[model samples]
Target: MTGARRDSCDVAVIGAGMAGMATALFAAERGLSCIQVGNPGGILFASGLLDLFGVHPVAERRLWRSPYAAIAALAREQSDHPLARIDASSIRTAFEIFVAALGAAGLRYAPLGDRNRSVLTSIGTIKTTFGVPLSMVAGVDALEARPPCLLVDFRGLREFNARQIAESLGHRWPDLRHRRIEFPGTEAAPELYAAHLARALESRQTRERTIALVKPLLGDALAVGFPAVLGLARASEVHAAFEAGLEMPVFEIPTMPTSVPGLRLLGALETAVSARGVRRRHQASVRALAFDREAGTAALDVEGVPGVERVVARAVVLATGRFTGRGLTADRGQVRESILGIPVLQPASREAWHQRDFLDPSGHAVNRAGLAIDDAWRPLDADGKPVWPRLFAVGSILAHQDWMRSKCGSGLAISTAWAAMEQVARQLRGTGAG
Candidate 1:
């Protein structure tokens, strides 16, 4: 550690998942010199929908119309839940800020409201979520109205099958129809990917040709729905052009992951954080982290490069996420925090990790295994004390809640980052550390 290259920042955020990005964005917004470490591989799996709260009492799988109401109920019943612990107003504000930042970065979302909207998935199933991207907002209205609509899919795009979606929902709306068409220049191509198609749509020629092919298939349909592949960076323009050319409300149904929307989301976040002066180490991972009590700073050894480099920060936020993101690692014995070996609150034994049934109503116990944090958002050690004065944990890494089943992943990430950064800023200013 003696001769390694070193840099200092007001805050060093570990991980580049939703939570980590939010932490860095908020930290930079507060004028904190921020350093963000880790790859953003986790974000590529995003569905592009910001879910605040959709299901509560996850055991029942009950869906809620108003996220605020669901959050209130969770607070009353499951007071320890992260989303429940945060006030509705704060959560709302956090979503607003996060969405606005994305909008500023060219990934605009529909105006967020109090009620949750039902979005049609690529598979024809409906999903309840709080915030809908502008490109897909029309699907919300189409779902509510159930008007005569035409669903279109490219012949080579195996991920999206318009016929399948139409048939799946045919019982509910008999008038719904579907068609498959050859993409403008992919007639000879046997298969098509959403990302490539999204980029192609950005070209005027491709957009017009694709629109011409669909215009004839419109028939009696009042609206048109396609897979979420309008455009990559220029989604708004492509969506607007489609609506004008088709002379109808056009919408996008979110396809499965490794999708165009996910890519767009990641790009926008990177843009937002970078615009705010947050240094990125997207190709790096934190190898070792040590806190210097006397210096009131934390030293992080970032790997994934030619040589190790150290980053010193007044405060540190761990947003490494859950198993998939490797924030928590598992073994024959128990789940352990990936970094610093912080105490993880898991089930008694591996036997209790899962129930006999895969689809258990209450969910598997391992989904709730994560670090336990105190009120200040600081991860607790074995003795139930803060691991460090400025060490904080956010997102799915925290225990006592199942974000996936609860359908509050975005809310948990954004709100916790916002709350934790508030404490970080206050502490730094109070101690005159930054």
Candidate 2:
């Protein structure tokens, strides 16, 4: 490894997904000199929905708590700690601020309430709204307390199975009424759809056209659902305006591989971080970390162009993501810690790794395989001691939780990063590091 004396920042966040970006931003806002180092696109490979909760209706109350409760728990643990320092209220406030910043940067997000019922998508599949199952779409009345509903879809977009969804749910709630409306054009060109709607809205033609199209179908309907793509960030305001003019409750169904809301969030977060002067180094993989306990700092060995370089920082946040992102690894007959060699909490044998089938929705229950961190979010040794005074962990890197199966990836990232930043801030204040 080539040794280089690089400029040291108060915190060096490794990874640039929602978690990493949030940690860096919060750290910088606290007057900490923060540097974000990681691959260019952190979570581009998987779906990007900021799923706060996905507990099935049957397990909701027993398995998981409400969003507010989770945030409160994070706040309680992070307050006065060392890593980045912010509170629960500040966390929510920061999210809103970040949203506004995104809006100003040409991206937007519509806050859907805490209802987790699934809604029918144009493709005919049902997606859980808050945490409700998509299979329950047929029971519309029971799901949303609304009457017969209409499902809308863009003509060009395929892969939706409205027929199957109707068939499955209809068996239980035959009274539910279903209809289809296909928007013009191909699904390939999203910008085209967004632009067409934007111009129509700007010219007042969209409102008129929408009324003409929906008047016959809605004659007297109360609610409707459509593909999440309907609310493209660039045109969300226009879409919302149109929805208001139509006087209908239009809910968006989650789509595949980076749903509409997920895409919007990814774009919004990148824009927000960039505007804050945080230099994001994407596609740069971190290979290892060397810590200097005496200096209360660490140097990250990153692999990319110009060979390897050791980056020094007073603190580091690891948000490399979950299994799909390669943050956690499972090899033949062995499960090893990919980065930092952090001790893992794993099964006794490969046979215990998971159940029989790969597609089993139960997923691998090995939540203990993630990075082991103390209450302060600092990496912990096998002896259960903080490994490095300045090194911190966040997001999927933390062990003791399985975000994918738990349906808490977004919440875990957001809340943990918020807590990590709060702790970092306390550390800075107490030690005068920054």
Candidate 3:
């Protein structure tokens, strides 16, 4: 253990997904020293559009124009839900701060409001989300008016198809047209990826050439849409250039996962948290965690690059997420929390994990299985008491809520993180630790 290093902070965050990132950002903003652990690659699954609450009562598939109204209904119907426990004011403030941090990192968004916007997906389906990136905001308007628009795609980009999108919405949007063009300098390549195309567009010469190719193709079209391959780091500039070169409103439809938008989102978040002075263990994972009840601190064993390093903090926030994040694991018998053997709130038997129908509207029982938390956002032990005074849980790792079906994944992450951090700060102040 001679080569191993030791560090301390006010808070140590586990996981680098949206929830973990939000927690670290909020902690740093509140003058708390923070060290974040786990790989950030999970953020690649994001679509860049943040959903705050679009659906309620998963069984009914009811959509909502206003997320606050949906939350009200959710609180009335399902009081145990983690999201229902948070008030509307706090949720709004959390989103505002989160979005502003992203904007400062160069990823600007359209102004947020009380309503959810309808965004067009790669497969021509409309998704209701609260926060829309500026690059994709035009699609919301185009989708609303059903205007005459041109959709463009590259020849070898397999993930996105402009023709398919037009075909899917043909009946409802008759004037929507589709076109395909060979991306400049990629004609020899048999397959074009979204990330590569996005990087290529960052070069002004390449961006101008691509715009030239599309300008001739846009005839009598009020607006134009493309697969979200606008410049990766300099997306705002590239998007503006396209609208100027084409002399019309331009939009981007989110493609499949591992997309350029996801990359941009991750990069901006890293920038946001780093600027606020949060230390990051980008290549590390927590091997083991122990709490010193009498000392009022938690020790984390982080396994990473050189060797295993120890990180102690006055408070620890678990945003490790669910099955994909390995925060909760299951075997033949039952599901259990991954670290520290915290009791997981799950089905009584493995047989009840899923419903008879695979596509049940209510979702599988297993999807809602996770660690149960007390009123202060701390994970509860078997007896329904907080395991530790400063050990708290946030994000999808909490039970009694299915974020995917409810369309509140981002909401659950950001809002709970904000609420939990408030408690963490207050508790640390009372204990006078760090």
Candidate 4:
């Protein structure tokens, strides 16, 4: 499956993250032969919230428009193309569809609604919400006005800081009872955490032992909150069992750089794409793209494997992500596209790359460094002309937007992928590819 085949697809997408997956799914549903490549499991590094809009007090004053407007514009432009698609009435509606699809696969997203302002984090920060479990009214109601809360950290998870979280919020909610209980699994190597959890789930003794270790901390507590990766994939079952024994409201908080929800999403997407006959090859890094300008085809080289090539369809969707995903490149003083050598929009220097602090709301505004496109989401050359008639760009690859810090990563992927699919479908219809 890695080698070149005489087969043809209506659309071929690169990168398998949210954008790529959504694009492929939309294309396939429209009866297009779609081929998808790359690994999007990097979503695990994201906070599982579907930041459809940045409605939080801290986020509303930004230069961008509401998520609704952004998605509407994408859908409108995409509708001009040939694909069958759905227009989401609002950001919340789009999120509902996303959550529903996830739930059908046994993964659930409990919408907290849009009217809430206070969210309880596992580490104790009162974050605002657009609609995530931590920000739900139920989550807030579970706290019952900042009672004494016990925060637990696996000894080795250095990403979470109990002390910092406590200090940041404790000053405001002085009565917020905070305690850190470190579990023994912290002694294991960082890479071993997931493996250790799998082993624990398979072993009754380990599971019981872990429950026993944390049993003493939950004594008569009003509620309990911990990082999402609490060694539990069936959260409801685990929460039920814990409640049956401890009689406490247990909830999980979203953690960064590989949250549990993000992991679940990747798994769900893999299953969905595979079921639809889409072949997925992981770690099969594409070294170069061979474009037949006359034949209107592209051949991709599978690195480290000789005589292996994938001749994809004439139309390609470059959903490859930003710098971290290797879609964009940065050198001493220049930034450009890595694959296909497309020109990119970049800042003047490293100092202008980001703001000083990671938590600074303004840290991730490198929009100019992304792929430039017209209203149709097609990649534009330096002269602002469409580079390829059939090639479309979506997600983080587009310039002038920061999905992560702006809390719109998932939304951007979904809407832009939808738009790109519509465009491809239209083109295919015009060319009789389908």
Question: Which number leads on lDDT?
Answer: 3
Clash number for each model: 0, 27, 0, 9
Better of 2 and 4 by TM-score: 4
Candidate 1 deviant stretches above 4 angstroms = none
User: Which is the winner by lDDT between candidate 1 and candidate 4?
Assistant: 1
Better of 3 and 4 by lDDT: 3
RMSD of each predicted structure: 1.0, 6.0, 0.9, 5.4
Higher-lDDT candidate of 2 and 4: 4
Please, what are the lDDT tens digits per residue for candidate 3 over residues 247-308? Answer: 99999999999988899999999999999999999899999999988888899999987679
Candidate 2 TM-score over all chains jointly = 0.75
How does residue 6 of candidate 4 score in lDDT? 40
In model 4, state the lDDT of residue 397: 80
- Estimate the TM-score for candidate 4: 0.77
Q: How high a TM-score does candidate 1 get?
A: 0.98
When summed lDDT is taken over every stretch of 10 residues in candidate 1, the lowest stretch is 81-90
Candidate 1, lDDT over the whole model? 0.91
Error of 4 at 65 (Å): 14
1 against 2, candidate with superior lDDT: 1
Model 3 — TM-score against the truth?
0.99
Worst lDDT run of 10 residues, candidate 3, spans: 37-46
